[model samples]
Target: MTVTESAQKPEAPANEEQPVVYKSNLEDFEREADVRLPFLLSYREVKLLGIAGVGFFLDAYDLFIINPVATMLQYRLYGGNELPANLEGFVKAGANIGSVIGQFAFGYSADYFGRKAVYGKELMLIIFATIGSICDPTGAISPSGSLIWLGVWRIILGIGIGGDYPMSASVATDRANLRRRGTLLSYIFANQGWGSFVGSLATIIVLLCYKHTMEVDGHTSKVDGVWRILVGLSLIPAFGTLYQRLTLPESTRYAEAQKAAQRVQDEESIEQLKKKANADPGVSEKTKHSSDEEGSGTQTPTVETATAESQSVKAAKELAHAKKGHFKEFFAYFSEWRHLKVLLGTCVCWFLLDIAFYGVNLNQNVVLQQMGFDGSEGTPWNRLFKIGIGNLIITALGFVPGYYATILTIEKLGRKWIQIQGFLMAALFLGILAGKFYTLNTPSFIVCFAFLQFFFNFGANTTTYCYPAEVFPTRFRASAHGMSAACGKAGAIISALAFNSLTKSIGTPAVLWIFVGCCIFGAAFTLLLPEVRDRDPDVVYEQELRERERARH
Candidate 1:
């Protein structure tokens, strides 16, 4: 039934204990949940965050590691010639395409089946796909075939990585206390930086160990081991977190919603029974005496029996509703414009931020060259080592620190203000880089790139993830988060697919100009979103409920 139709049912008789009891219980749960949960992070909260963070860490590692690994594959598969331009973009963007599908599917599933039921299954998919990526055939297939094989596995891996966005965001936001909700989510998301760093660092370490052997061979055969090892190492963390995700209890808020839905069903059932009795006076008199005798024997038993009957009716209704499908309910719930606008703000802001963010990130090799890490001065093995070191250094200077800054001040700065400022500041740096593309010295370029990285994380990137998790009601929170994240990945896919070709056609200066525009538009879109600092979603939902009731009257 539509929410309005359900809400319009006749009020239960004043003497009915079932409706009163359920209302009181639900109110008490909300009061305690809002006031007590947000103030502290206990062991349980830490465990939840850690379990969720692992998926994000793996997501970043699997996605970003492709850059360096693809570089290695070019050497091994194509005799150090540059990978074909079409294949290069396809390989880089494959995971993002898979992630878009995964986000939508898993986001809706999490809401439909309950978070705990679907939480860790994505990790299992990642583990399997990561292993498959490592096993990509070399001699068995032509060069293009090999690249195609790896790309297909990356897409599968991307599906798992994509699922993590909504699953982890919903889990973290649901468990976090109102005061530290932003801080907790930042901690989970900060893992993306660490994942990127570790992916680079791992490649560097493996390359150093194999540098001599690969140099002596004079062919790219041994370099094949490097890509396999780098891809396979991700399996370690995914395996470690699997059991915990599978075992996590459903969020308290979700549990409460299940109870509330049940209460509504019970209220409706009792109303139906009262009408039935009124229509048959003879049966009503007989039933009335029976109830009185039962009540006289024990008032408590009579009340308990009525409450039990209400609960059973609720269960039956819930089952019937379940059979009708969640997608219908999802659209019905979000059909209102006010609710739809919040989803739009989250999706658009993320879309704009990612187009610039991933465009820079996935194509870091271009920026690294500007910083003098282009590997021109050394052998092929040494070039790989320098690239790895360059990635690690840039991540240390810009990426990791930016995420921590957001964690430290997200609550104080508020999501909307920080996102706005981050986008505007990032745009400023992009303009500087574009305007000085040819003239800027290596040190100056590095400084500008560092500032851009800092603001992207400290601003829209973190806030975009946190906002969807906080703004939507629990029933649709996961789906909304997934949709927003999918929009962001769509931006990432566009960057991955188009960055190389765009640079070839327009020159690097023009491309940077486009990114600067994306940042400016991202800032403009930030105006549409609400500030969620210290705000509880449950309280927001209650206020919305009251507003709807007033409109109906």
Candidate 2:
């Protein structure tokens, strides 16, 4: 019924400078953190998911909502004219640009400081950015100025979106029991599908509520309410999650890593004190003999002084290391070929996956047109309604189902297998879609697009997310994941900026072929990763380091 998480120091303290809890038996704490909590579906596990999961839900919502919002904006600002191509690219890619910054900054911060220290700060950034985005003063600004305004706010919004990648991944992996680590990570990420689906659903529902208005006034200014309301809806969840995120407990594994570090420093201080204490053997022996003869024994002043000096030396070293600790640790860990290659693999694969994934996604309206579901030949309300309805069907048919497929099969099939197959299958579909681009009828194109989405969710898209968080040791986990995620976002920025222009120049079929190539390369890069199921990276890293030291000796 209840799984008592053998408590490590409670993560939320009343104040920032509260005393550190020192546990001397670091191994026992390690076992407690890495081994026990995963034994069952406890309330603590649920609470952790709720707190971490909400931000990811927001991640997808904030990022993808822009698509529909952009469509609605055409009506609101341009009176149903096509959105300016340059502005459209900027508006869509802005969040991703900010995300790259957030991913790198927050990823390093999470690992370098502590998850506890920085957990909610990114969410705080997100809330502010979201507000800034929805509150764009369209009336005060020209259409072009308004687009620039939304673009700027979304860049800020992207930072929060980007930060969540590493923050949530590291938090989930550090605490997950090896048995269900993949499952836990998948479930947290699966919130994205819901975010995507719900964004469209809300657009539809809210637009319907204004059915009479849009119908009465074609290309009406009232469309402004639809986009703004959709953007604003995400705020409710953000506000609801703020108190919990700010106060949620730090990952137990992270806490254990900290304690282990303290223990090593303490041990070194003791060792240094002993070396200094015996420096003058004659004086120390004489003092010891005199104390024994007096029926009592005590440390000589020299010994006490040596101990104080050693403690002070440790303190000073700690302070200096604190200045550049995480920076040093990050570079040192990834410096070796063995470690560096793995990081590269995750980065390369994620980078490739995003290029294709976001390319298709950012231009979904184009795809919908290819499938005859674009609602282009309709009244004003009818056009918006058709777009909304098409999004709902497409998202429902592909996005959520694909994610669920991975969740169900990930443990048995393994992350590497799923990822490789997912990439290959997606490439295959993209190839078919490219070949049949003009030839295919509506039903055929829908089938290809749906299956492409399916494999993407089931393969590299979800697994790209899981791999980095699980494969790196605690010391570099956040930074590495952030780096990988940043690379992926960089790819997204590429596609977001280029997809429209690329399709215009080369045609959508050629663009589909390019995505096919990206997917094929994605599968190739996926080959670089080892199977991470049922293993802990920290233990593997320590073991490898020890073996290397022995070999060097």
Candidate 3:
């Protein structure tokens, strides 16, 4: 038997004497889905994961790769001079701005339309915009103009990357078995670390390939190709996964919900028609007899025709009600304080995490400089190689391992505990860095920095993504995840735009102090979220509906 087939719960034999339990259709469907899907990874599940995960890989690559690309641009476009601080901030922040917009727009679209409708379109956007960014017209435009061109394309790329947040998270969460949902999501998110590592590795390899040619005649002309090629390589995975995303089926939960809603609408429509027919004084005996025969299929031809017409009218009314209820039901469902609190917790925690997360990520080179890996005294190629090695070491020591640790332990430790510990530990390390900024030697700094990266991934970063996807009901899961993610990106934008100037004004130590505070607050906010390990979100949603119904009565 297939995994899905083997996972199914055996049905009890029906007995005429025993009355059947009248379960709500939605609840019944949820129960069936829960039984049919298992936590074990089948070939099909892995394929789905890879296809969904490619976007996150690109997101990480496109976002972090800019660091090296920006350095290369400094050489190729500005004659080896650093970009002006303001332009540099804008260029770094452009994609984040686009991401904020995409998250809000795409999140709502996924909830309002269907997940399948919006899944792969964002990947296509990423492919197009990534190509546009790499092909920035350096020769045809002034240096500043070239920067602007790349920034514009990066923003477009950010939008697509942003869409991937909700699309992938929702798709993965919707299909995952309860026992392995967190693990599967962590697996998908772990791709971000890999993407970052690969971006660094790719830059190093490409720089080496062109180092000799660019060094000749003291001209660094070939260095320009390094960033372009790095950015261009992301397109390969994007294209490869596009067909899978486009062809993937809509989530079973969503399909079942629609069916349940239609069944309810049909029942209500038939009941209302019965009441109207009973109350009408002008109804003739013949008309009454025909109405009674509608179900039995023993009516005359004219009566049969009238019954068919009535059924069509009911169908039209049902469709209208479904359309009207779409937005109304969303607002009404979330208006309850209990539901809204989950959203608030997710958004706030994510926001707090990103402020520190992006601040450190986007400005990691500054941290590396403090460790004496700045390569200031070396040739351009030597400098690039050192930077790549530093990044690779950082990823190896911290980012990649942290993500895998979360994957291995997430199901066991519980998301809340891991997130809380991650935040507190991250804060502790940040405090160490802040207090010992100048006093610490190179090895000490690397140790602290590596620990911070490790906890950040193992803690809030992975949990934040996993929680929002799992906590919300299917009707609003995508939208809620999007809003939370968008809020996080907003924090990233603030960090990116303000970090450079903030560092200049208050020094790096003071900035590290601020990040430490953010991490603390992130941990505090995480307390507001419930621990959701191994729980089916649909089951929780059904319980909530029962409670709401009970309160009304």
Candidate 4:
């Protein structure tokens, strides 16, 4: 019976625990979900963020820890000679390369396979790779061999690391309500700041462990233990989330959308059956007319069709679902210029942001030295310790705070404006630093650098991560976000490989100018993105599909 018609008939027993049964109509349910997601915040949301966010925390820890780890490696492995230029570049860029692979691979997998099936597998790769990395027999191998060993395992670890980008983003975005979508995403992305802070803090604490030896021997070989410990600590958070990531239930939003897709599937199947029955020579004209009614594009599930489920039909449906809903669907959705442009914008913006972001960040030691915290004039332990202090100062004053600032302000200011102003402000600082590279005194340069860090997080860095998760439809969200993020990693890879060489060839001032150019162009691309506040990609996609159908009629 129709839900409204049955409503007046009778009531169920009050003693029984009951389903809410509010909206039998799928369209009404979708509408309510859009409103309810933002308003609904509870333990479930917190638990999800807590689990999914670990990947990001690990991401920041591993990515930044390398800074100190590399310094430690310098003393422990090379007796403080600068690492081979090629090996240093590979070590820095390797994880990012793996991230690109993981982003593309997992992004597509989550969308096609459903979030739950593919969710925790990336963590497995991370665990395996992390273990492999720490076990790199540095004492037994040649310097080149040790570097290769570390680089290789990091790349493997990176695959899992990179995969987490799309996997976590999709999981968060899929579960998030429309009202607080930006805030929810920002909370997750902000973990990177803490991850970075913890990495710095960890270095200080670990370095202190062998302070006596460091001071006595200057550049003692015992420093080998330090990098391994930092790399291994990431495993603690990784293991904490592995069980939860594996056990994650399918997203409620994704489940509801699947119901809608199945309803459409049933309507198609019933139409096909009607057409075949009518084509029989013995079939009457009335049956043919009924077939036409069935083919009239009615989307809501009818009582007969909804009840038509049987073991055999379900078996076919499952098989058909597996075969049909893959790449062609993704392609059909993005075939139009309007949709294509958004995907393009996300990719381009993220790519540009990472180019500048990584370019500036990876060169922190250079900036730290300019601020007069250089470890160059000291003993081995003192030199490494001085740079660690520099890293700690930068992380405290700028990097961590900027992310939290975006979290507080993003929902109010809207993503587009924040990204625009962030880019403009960041460009302003980089331009000042680049223009006054030689002339600026210590305090002034640090001020400009700190503000630059502030604006990157407050503006594009956090927002770029948010946009991909928000801008695309559910079925395509993971894949699109993955592609966008992978492109960003590609930018990082280029910068990692080239920045040091570029700094040497053209000079640091010229390199900062290039970053300024990247940041300014990044702002221009921000215009291509929608505000994403109060909007639901799936809800909007449904509306557009209906509008197109109406126009066709």
TM-score each candidate. 0.86, 0.85, 0.87, 0.86
Model 1 local distance difference test score: 0.81
After superposition, which runs of candidate 2 have C-alpha atoms over 4 Å from their true positions? 1-41, 217-219, 261-324, 548-553
Candidate 4 RMSD to the correct structure: 7.0
Q: Report the lDDT tens digits of candidate 2 across residue range 38-105.
A: 32344556766776788778878876788878888888888789899889889988989999999999
Q: Cα RMSD to native, each candidate?
A: 6.6, 6.8, 5.3, 7.0
Name the regions of candidate 1 deviating beyond 4 angstroms: 1-41, 217-219, 262-326
Q: What TM-score would candidate 3 get against the native? A: 0.87
- Could you give candidate 1's per-residue lDDT for residues 1-553 as a string of tens digits? 1000001122455764222111222333345555653434555556766788998898888777888888888788888888988787777888999999999989988888888789999999899888888888887899999889888988898899899999988877766656677888988999999998999899889998897788777655788998889989998888888888888776666655554444444555566767888999986897799878987867567667767777668655674565345566578667978778888989999999999999999888899899999665677798888998899888888899999889888877898999999999999999999999899999999888999899989988888899999888776789999999999999998887888888999999899899999999989988888888877665566456546546644
Report the C-alpha displacement of residue 1, candidate 4, in angstroms.
38
Candidate 4, 1-553: lDDT as tens digits: 1011100112444753332121222344345556653434445556777877888888888889987888888887887898998898888889999999999999998877788889999999999999999998998989889999999998998999899998988888776655677887888888898899898899888888888876876548888888888899998988888888888777755554554455545555666766777677455466767768777636547646856878668745753474365576678779988889899989998999999999888878889879887688877777777888888888888898899888787877899999999999999999999999999999898888999999999999999999989889776889999999999999999888888889999999999999999999989988888889877777677666656646644
After superposing candidate 3 on the true structure, give the runs of residues whose Cα lies further than 4 Å from its correct spot. 1-40, 261-323, 550-553
Q: Which has the better TM-score: candidate 2, or candidate 4?
A: 4
lDDT of 2 at 194: 92
Q: Cα deviation of 460 in candidate 2 (Å)? A: 0.5
